[model samples]
Target: MSEALQILQKYWKHDRFRPLQQEIIDSVLSGQDTFALMPTGGGKSICFQIPAMVNKGICLVISPLIALMKDQVANLQKRDIKAIALTGGIKSNEMIDLLDNCQFGNYKFLYLSPERLQSDWILDRIKNLPINLIAIDEAHCVSQWGHDFRPAYLKISGLKDHFPNVPFLALTATATPKAKEEIITELGLHNPKLFQKSFARKNIAYMVFETDDKLFRIEQILKKNPQSSIIYVRNRKSCLEISTQLRYLGFKATFYHGGLSSKEKDKNMLLWMQDEVQVIVATNAFGMGIDKSNVKTVIHIQLPENLENYYQEAGRSGRNGDKAFAVLLTNPSDIAQTENQFINILPDKAFLNSIYIKLCNYFQIAYGEGINEQFSFNLNAFCLKYKFPVLKTYNAMQFLDRQGVITLSQEFSEKITLQFIIPSKEVIRYTSLNPHDEEILLAILRTYPGIYEMQTAFNLPLIAKKSNHPETQIYAVLQKLKEKGIIDYHSRNNDSTLIFNEIREDERTINRVAKYLENQNTLKKEQFKSVLKYIKEDKVCKSKLILNYFGEKTTEDCGICSYCITKKNKKTNTIPLSKEILLIITNEELNSREIQNRINNKSDDVIFAIQQLLENEKIILKPNNKYILKL
Candidate 1:
């Protein structure tokens, strides 16, 4: 066995690689820069991981999502592999320690966000490390034509200049031909080998239903296929509402979104993963690193902004190669809503400038100051204070982040830990004086150890369960304890981190990037139109349409998709008419109207069968407008 194969077996316990995985790995091992285009759930990670294990030095992975990076690092550590992810919001000292570990602690994999590359300190330190290969995940984001474009990715090509000999590997689940070319050109990949897996999933039955009663349709689908499923919504409110509705209908369902605390998210995800919940209704924030193979369905309740997002999300189903369904539920209003929500309301240059200036002022950063400073920003507070629309403001922040003006690290549900500030005797005395808080304090002390000496992870739900108190009541008690100086407590909440990449610039600076914003708006409008087209058009095969959109051509129809099935039903329903037409044409000559009147089928069916019979020579059309059977 090859060394890579042996390592894969040892760690991943896989005997073989999925299609195109080993080929891509071989390309990487040959020290050739390679670009891999594999669909979602195609095991793209193993391609780089196995090669990194077989090589001598660490593999540096640049990814876009902090959650994905953290999940991969945790998984690798479980297998006794040394991997570390340096995401945003890390203290400088912690970052120094992490880099030190990567350089000297035998760490084989280092994952960091693309924005981290902008730091001269980080890049300088990375140059000193014994780097074997550079891997870029979500490589399509580097292209202007791609669905999710990030300007930080354009800086990735600089790594080549620093690491002159190291090969690079770029991986993405969805990319068009233009995006593919741009990825190669922008990343400066040297004569790269390209490996593309077919964008077709035969096991997935792509379906789109236009209905006013989506809830009824969803219930019917769940009743028919009571298996593991994910229902994607557009926002947090819908996620919770849909999940609640599913539960009321007797389904074991859970909800997930960015608004949930980290502990709550983990608990809900664990329940769904363990089959305790049949469905997970969530926003797009869920499912980045989810590896559930038996997810039999992925239903989109709202129209996605583009085909790329839809394909990636729907491809999460049927990973185990079993029959699964990717059902998109939409009404007429959803089409218009999607267009207006995504394309029509894009922040213009002036609005973006206003947001930028407000953001700087919010942080009390003087103009031409605050470069590289990180702050915990409350987005709701900022929006409320400025009377700005929440969604538009958030989109503007994303636009600014894309333009490399600032980096926004979204709220992570990382658990909070706390330690007591006073002695145990002091705590007992205080609790005795306040008997109302005694039960909670005693429960905390009994349920968690090292609370006095170390900052232990505070599990509110678990503590509530143990203390036989409602979670809200427990939270109140914890706050009371914190106020009384009995014990330190940290509550989990959603708070985003903002890192200023450059000094605050004048409004004129915004004009410099106005063209870029306009171009992006145009691209977004085009993408939204494509999505609308996908939803409104019913004649084309869904799978075929998606494949073509992704730059793959296919003449054959997936016989199992919604359109193919409808066509099959139409063909089946006409079979009886063909039989009846032959029966009527035995030896007697008859005209078309006579045959149509005699046959009990629809007139159209009779005409179609007559055309079929004449084409097959089973009957002949006479000059007198009569049909007769041939010997």
Candidate 2:
């Protein structure tokens, strides 16, 4: 067996490598910086993991989402491979201990959030470690012009200054031509080889339906598939409403949004993953790092803001190489709503200034003084309190982020807390009945006085270790205590922070990147508008339209699109409204509405017949309200 295949079987329990995956792994192993563009479910992780496992030193994986980090670490440990993650959710002592393990323990992989890159200690520690390779997941975030840009990702190139010999692997599921170039340039890869898999999914049929009744369309889609499916919406309220409608239709459906507590999110996800729930109605927060293989369909209830987001979210279906469907339901009204959203997103200079002033007022902090201060933002609540337009205000804040004035974290962020629900006296009584938990319970009560007083929010894992209890058992005990009316437990959430990171924003510094980003936005807007063109175009095949948009040069039509099906079975164009029918209607001289009622045919067909008669000079639209024959 080949060496790569040998490692794949021993670790991942697979005999073969996925398409283009082996090529990527081989490039990174050869000490060359690699750029990989694979569609979703193309096995992007194994590209880095296989090479990391074969190399001598630890691989540093820089990711933006904490949930993704946790997932990868868990999967790695399941194979008895040593992996660790450094994130903000843990206690400071725990973070230090984790860092210690990375430095001393024989760990093969270390996953970290991009925000940690700005820390002086993390950089210093990384410089000392014998790092082998650096992998940047979702590498498109490095480009400010990209749809999902992150400021912390800009600092990733600095690692090369410390470890000049380590090759970097940048991987992403979706990126435009512009984003791909920016990623390669920003990373300063040493003659990096780019591996690109085709963005086309042949087995997945794509279609767009224009309808005034999107909710009805969603119901129809669910009824047709009736299997594992995901419905994507734009916000939290819609997620719940659509899920409720699905359940009313007698389908097992669940809802997920950023607003849910971690416990709630986990419970919903577990139910769906276990096949106990047949459908999940969710916002954009639902798909990141999800590995379900049987999602037979993905339906978008509302149009996404851009194509990159739409493509990424829609690409979640058909992972198993089976025939799946992706549908987008919209109407004239939705187009207007989508345009208003984009127009509201303009980075107006004056609006940005007002936002700067509001931040100072909202936080009650002077200029250059809000550093290290964390505040919660409720968009509607803030707008109502300040009498500002909520939609426009959010757009202005995004512009401020681009201007380097503040940082905005859109995910539902909150202070995390882990506390015992029982009082000291009740704990003593319960411990006497359950001696087995006595030692662990006493240790917890002694180590965490703040939990007893309800003074601060704590992390549960830290408390579990301090109490010498299994993490899973501690969670169950906390739940049992809460059910007994001992105390209430609340989970953590993601929040946005406005940091005075750059003390000042000079126009020259901001305009350089802003101009580039604006052009990129223009291109994306044009791309989304073309989907409407495809819907109305009479001659173009749907599959050919999409492939051409992605710059595929093709003359032949795909034999599977709606256009192909319609072309293969053409209908005769016979007019049922004959001259005799028109003559009877003319004799009556009915009004346009009454003429349609007398015809006993579709109003559209009647209208078409009237136009043909007028063109042939057989009839005329009279001055008042009747059609008269030219004779």
Candidate 3:
């Protein structure tokens, strides 16, 4: 067996590599630059990890997501591999100690966000490490043509000058041919070995349904599948609402979003991962660096802003290779909703400048000063003070974040989590006994729908507002209840820290990056056009359309997608039985349309009955090509 195979077996316990994984690993091992354009679940991490293991030195990985960096580091640590990630919230002393550990402690993998490269001290220290391979995940971020372009990623090529001999491997789940080329050019990959797995996922049947009633379609899909699933929404409110609705309809579901405290996220993710919960409804922040092989379906009720995100989110399903589904439920209003959410709210130069100035003033930064200054920015308070629209102001702040003018550490947020320990009757008795606390307890009851059933995160300020009291008073009441063993509760402020990356230059800051920002805006518009076209165009195969979008060409249609199913139904004598019925049909409902619409799904029974009836001549095909049943 090859040494790479040996490493894979030792750590990952896989007998062999997936298609193209070995080749990419071999290319990097041979000291050749490699570009891997694999799908989301195609196991891209092992390509760099195994090579780094085969060699003696630590592998340097630059990623765009802090959550993914931390996740990879934790996974590697669980495997007894010494790895370090320099994500947000690390103090300077802690960063120095981590760097020292990497320099002398023989760590195998070091993952850091590309934004960290802006620190000269970090770059200088990293240049001295015994780096063997450079892995750039999310390589599309380096290309301005890419859907998620980050300006800091462009600075990664400078490392090439530092580590002249170390080979580079770039990986991205979704990238266009143009973006691929730009990634290669921007990173200065020299005669890179390219390995691209086909964008087609044969086991996944992509389905798109045009329905005004999305919740009905979601219910229908879940009832048919009834397995582990993820429902992606565009907003946090929708996540909670959908999860509650699914639970009301008798499905075990939980909600996750960025606003959830770390403990809440971990608890909810664990419940879903362990199959204690059958479904997890969440926003886009839920699925990075987490893989569950048994997820049978991924439902997107809201049309994603772009197809790249949709493909990645939908690809989370069916990883176990049994037949799975990727369903997209869209209504006519979704287009306008998408545009207004993503495009119309996009910040222009004027908005960007105004927002930047407002931020500097909000933090009390002096003109031409405030370089390297950081502040704990309460987004709600800032928006309220300025009377700026929340979403638009947040978008502008994100624009500034992307342009490197400010570093917004949104990951550092907190929320109140609580649940009633006593039964409803006991809680009511306690509330009556404690009349002074009754108002706050009642406010909690009115604010949270399932406080007695399960623990969940809540908006503390909102609860306070509901109780017509100060937030401190609400916190004190919850604490008193906890002490009395009436309820379990905790609360923390939800504040995002903002670090000013550049000196306070009001208008020039926005002007300096106006062209780049405008170009990105245009790219977003173009991306939405493709998204709209893909959902609206039912003539082309959905799988083929997605495949072609990533520059892969194939002549044959995937015969399992929604388009293929619809095309098959167009032929003669194809009974329009619901997929729910195709799975199982009971004896009593064999000839009943109403029951057939809600039949049990057991393949063998249905197939066996068909064979028995055909052989006994109880069923016959007539000359008109209709199946006639003679009892």
Candidate 2: minimum summed lDDT over ten consecutive residues — where? 501-510
Residue range 326-408, candidate 2, lDDT tens digits: 87775556767767766546555555566666666776766446655556665544555576776678776765554445656
Candidate ranking (lDDT, best to worst) = 1, 3, 2
Please provide, for model 3 over 1-631, each residue's C-alpha lDDT reduced to its tens digit, 9 standing for 90 to 100.
9999998898888898989998998899999999999989999999999999999989999998888988889889989999999987889899999999999998999999888999999999999999999999999999888988988998999998999899999999999999999999999999999999888999999988764346756877888898999999987768877998888989999989997878989999999999999999999999998789999999999888888999999999999899999999876578888888999999888888888888888888999999888788777667756878878888888877877889897743336678898889998998888888888878889877787876666666566667778878887888888898978777676678889999998878778888888989999999999998888887899999999999989888999887887677456332333333333432322432233235453432333334334446655433332334554
C-alpha TM-score for every candidate: 0.79, 0.74, 0.83
Q: What TM-score quantifies how close candidate 2 is to the native fold?
A: 0.74
Candidate 1 steric clashes: 0
Maximum-lDDT candidate: 1
- Runs of candidate 3 exceeding 4 Å displacement: 411-490, 572-631
- Comparing 2 and 3 on TM-score, the stronger one: 3
lDDT computed for candidate 3: 0.84
The digit string of per-residue lDDT tens for model 1 on 1-631 reads 8898899899999999889988999999999999999999999999899999999999999998888999999999999999999987788899999999999999999999888888889999999999999999999999989988888899999999999789899999999999999999999999999999999999999987654457767887888899999999997657867887788889999989886777989999999999999999998999897889999999998999888989999999999999999999866567678766887678999899999999988889998898988888767657757878877888888888877788887663424456789998898888889888778778889976667865565656566666778878987877776787766667666568898888888686688777878878888888887887787666789889899998889989898887777566566556677777778778587876677678776544565566556657877765455677877
Question: How close to the true structure is residue 230 of candidate 3, measured as C-alpha lDDT?
Answer: 97
Candidate number of the best TM-score = 3
Error of 3 at 163 (Å): 1.2
TM-score of 1: 0.79
lDDT against the true structure, per candidate, is: 0.85, 0.73, 0.84
